[model samples]
Target: MRHIHDAPAGLIDFLFTELLLSLKDQGYSEFSLGSVPLAGLEARRGARFSARLGAYIYHHSTQFYNFEGLRSFKEKFDPEWRSVYVAVPPGANIVAVVADVVRLIGGGGRDRVGGKASR
Candidate 1:
């Protein structure tokens, strides 16, 4: 679920509707729209600068990812979003671990098969 380059308005709506209907006919009632990175992040009171910076990037950086748009699109289907988190071992380099994860999950320098990007 990425951008529709030069696609006509409502094209995505049609495609999603068709896909959902097909899935329903195939006896699949539950559809999982994949996770949107940082879409539901929350900073507790007295949060640190890193947490605030991450939230800012998630909300504003459309060139990197359409985070807000993806969440809005998924909401149209009446999804029940559950919070998910990742844990790292104590004393590990959190920054490096997160960088690796970004490369892995963000398809950094990946090839595309058909119309979809893959790593």
Candidate 2:
């Protein structure tokens, strides 16, 4: 049962709150919404160049990526933030791969994730 005042929050936030509550009622000790794309990307000393770029994207790419907005939405659930690391093999073109991904997602291709190709 949800009360009107129980959610002064927005639609997405309200839905996630209810979903989490439902999971807790169903004996779920943990729930994961996976990693929010660019959360916790602050510029700090001794950080990787990729980390700095992520911080830039997170701060500046609002039109393309809703980094802080998603982060804020997830923060409503008080989730425990964790650092995730990725390793690349020697001499891999990580930058190019990421650029391709961004281009793909930003509708720069005839081959989007679930989009069909021209016949």
Candidate 3:
């Protein structure tokens, strides 16, 4: 899941279509979408959708959150994790996730979590 606002349009839709087709092709007729919150990430509507879609496709990201961290976070809600992949265009800037994580942790170099900026 873990999609930023910058993700390309139709990306989620295409993924869903492919996933459903793949599952049917594999003779699976029963499936359900689940959702969980990312550890320490902001809780928003987009985040909620990302988590649900991620759970549906069993997709996990490794940039901002590690498998261990995601596992721990999702385990609180008793979710099952499945492995998936994203095929990025060659030379695309795929480091946005990492950069976002850095910004969040580094607080844009101010080290602020709330209204107080760290020195």
lDDT (0 to 1) per candidate = 0.69, 0.66, 0.49
Between candidates 2 and 3, the TM-score winner: 2
TM-score of each: 0.72, 0.64, 0.29
Top lDDT model:
1
lDDT per residue as tens, model 3, 81-119: 554434445554435433443344434646555443332
For candidate 3, what is the lDDT? 0.49
Stretches off by above 4 angstroms in model 1 are 2-4, 43-45, 90-103, 106-119
What's the distance in Å from true for residue 56, model 3?
26
Q: Pick the candidate with the highest TM-score.
A: 1
Candidate 2 to truth, TM: 0.64
**Runs in model 2 with CA error above 4 Å?**
1-9, 44-46, 97-119
Model 2: per-residue Cα lDDT over 26-109, one tens digit each: 999999765665457677888877777767777888886676776777677888888765565666565654455455444466
Model 2 residue 32 lDDT?
A: 77
| Residue-by-residue lDDT tens digits, candidate 1, 12-90 | 8789989999999999979887777666555666775445655776777788667788788888888888876767677
Residue 118, model 3: lDDT of 36
